[model samples]
Target: MKAEILYEAISEINPKYIEEADMRVITKINPWKRFLVAAACLILCISLSIPALAATDNSFAYELLYTVSPELAQNLKPVRETCEDDGIKMEVVAASIEGDTVNILLAMQDMTGNRITASSDLMDSYSIHMPYDQTACCQLEKYDSETGIALWSITIDQAESKLKPGDKITFSVSEILSQKEHTEIKLDSIDVSNIIEATEFTVDPQIRGGAGNFDEDSMECKRLLLPEENGYKLCDGVILTGTGMVDGKLHIQCKYDDILNTDNHGYIYLKNSSGEVDEYYSSISFWADNKTDSYEEYIFDIPYDELAEFEIWGEFWTCNNAPIQGEWQVTFAISE
Candidate 1:
């Protein structure tokens, strides 16, 4: 947005021209046609700094001018970049660069059906690649249910002033999730009233990380439950590994498969016979098997005699393991 930045961006343009194939065909362009195109580009560039004009929609010429003289590039017409896959179309609508940040606007539309929704998410499956080291994040900006179109905003920032005007940036998404589902599960099979303290416990190396009053790093390491039997299935891709009383505390462990991809996860707690959940509970999470499979253990300080009046309850988010997978990529340069 600064004049120095624009100068640096336009300085990369090469003014020289070389003869190419079909030169005669290219020279056939009428002077009037060329004049009209140039006039249109001049109007567009002049409106670039107009807030009202940009509020509606506009394209920056920073990338387009990188290959020609500043004068020619300033008058050159802009082209829209788009890609389609699996009945879906993705278009790079607008982009801009400000100091150490690059902002991009993208639009996606379902071509054959009304599958695109306001709840759709990239689910951390999107990537932005730049010539320099940077951090990128995206969020849904808007959605039109009637048109099956969704607009997303992506921001890429660098720790230092590494972003340049003509730098090529590629944005891609590999997976998309829609129709979020959240449910509460009741564990009626587990007789909390008859729960007994375990004699032996294992120091589960699968413990990735956790938080709570339970000092996992010290204090004799209050033990993890042993895989005694096939545990209760809380939901799809989620299992209640085991439950036991450990050192006067109730420990409830649950396993989730392919958490990185599916994001199938939940929290475990207890509800009274009147179906009221006690808010005083803490949890620690770890890798049950590997990075793909995760485990979370909830601990409660309730007395053993009072356990019977409480029932185990779980609240989970399941995407039905349904993700639309395809390659959607757009490459363009940031402009003022």
Candidate 2:
């Protein structure tokens, strides 16, 4: 009964106060609400073994309130359940249900070192297990450098209207990727600036997905030399295959080997003299083989004469090549 009142009082806290609480300010809440918040914090301090708490600092209060309030818990809290492996900790910070959709927030923290960065992402190797049939997607919401924590949001949509409060769901991840690097494409053999028009050097690869003005009917897959020979090593698992002026546009092609496993892919951009990226560009992706070899073509709308003023830049990740593989799973109940 006390937990219920504490939950209600915390729930009544102004949303604005909750936002300001991030800055460690506790204000405008009534005396009773403030007392409940303090009492909840005391309980959590004992339950979670918190070392200390500042009376004026309410940043921790928000998390404490989540323990008592289920609906509010979906946003932030240190859940009771956690799995730690390979010097990394995975915890279900929050879980709640809205209508037929269930949203779960999971946090991954690197305790031993700084391996978990802002770019740390799941390698499409995670799975969600629930009793009901549902479709779920997991995405990295944000990372806090101060606490060495990265939060991921998982949204699950039930097929039928069968989901309710207090239903348990299991979230699991097999691998995590970090240390994403971005670098300039420098070739020892291929001179990108002097590449002439070579529309004949194009090959038709299996289309996967694309962006920009590329037509689906006219799939323009630019063929390039094999990475084993003429390819320039851009990063781990990614290679620069070809560069040429196809028609009036500049075509930069890259090969992603073992794409399905590594999640090794990147963005190609042209940077000008002022270090500003050219936003107007189109790209298409295709598979040399179904799951093993993937190729991406970046088409830039610029004249060959101006190509000398621009440098090729790429943001790539070979995440799966050196992934932190572990079985991190957590079962948490959602509240409506």
Candidate 3:
């Protein structure tokens, strides 16, 4: 065995090795110099768990966040950010592919020294969804342009797999050190973007519903989903309707004349002048005690774009109209 290699290996041993009686200074001895060093001190036999190329974490604990689907449009945003220090590695793999939804297999493991295991089969791995619609690519081969590899490797050169939308699967640590302590992982949030057909008409969905009850000078227009003062129905689709060509601002006049209200973010989506459906959070802000006698205003803004279809979504609670009111108006400013 290489003497220098053996020397280096000995240095990595825990401090306990130094106190052993009869053991001379490992002058030129290192574990890598001879596998026998491990065979002698540690008789544990670990098997070939995962593919040889994948790297596994050396530490026992890890954090993992798997984004289900990646938005594969022209404009892609950050799906999720992950970080690891204690010998952990992250893996991405393909889960499913249905129309536009792309599911991704995310895995975290103790990769101090071992192969990481990931699979395309949905039967065994866990995954998350993201907007990975490579539909904008003129050619199927352009996938590499979008991302060189489907799965991103946090530790080694090669990752387990590449992934697409709507796919399902479980990703796991194929091989890990038996001696590693504290083994586990976490999931964080994700970001997404859209694929645009036309540059001038991209579905800029995120900025929607931002500004609210500004200093009054920015207030522009107001209209209801229908002529009735009732708040817009979620699933059926109501428009913050009347506005300049730009998707500027949105306002809602709640007609629940009698109920106190607390606003929340809901599942709002968009359909541009182009017909593509884009979903975003409808940031609704309203007075908590809405029935306090003074008329309160609820404001939501849509991102500015030359094209869009504004819609509301997400969980809804019943609105009691004792201060019973009618027709609510939503409005926005026109952008040039």
Best by TM-score: 2
- For residues 34-147, write the lDDT of model 3, one tens digit per residue: 222323212111110112111334111111111211122211212222334345544331122322222222333334533222311111011111111121100001111122
List model 1 lDDT by residue over 106-143, tens digit each.
67888998667776767666656544456555655567
Q: Count residue pairs with overlapping backbones in model 2.
A: 0
TM-score of each: 0.57, 0.58, 0.20
| Model 2: lDDT of residue 279 | 45
* Alpha carbon deviation, residue 133, candidate 3 (Å): 38
Report per-prediction Cα RMSD to one decimal: 15.6, 14.1, 24.4
lDDT of 3 at 330: 13
The best-first sequence of candidates by TM-score reads 2, 1, 3
Those runs of model 1 whose alpha carbons end farther than 4 Å from true positions after fitting are 1-80, 95-103, 131-133, 155-166, 184-204, 207-222, 227-229, 245-250, 268-292, 298-315
Residue 262 lDDT, candidate 2, scale 0-100: 61
**Model 3, poorest ten-residue lDDT window?**
135-144
lDDT of 3: 0.24
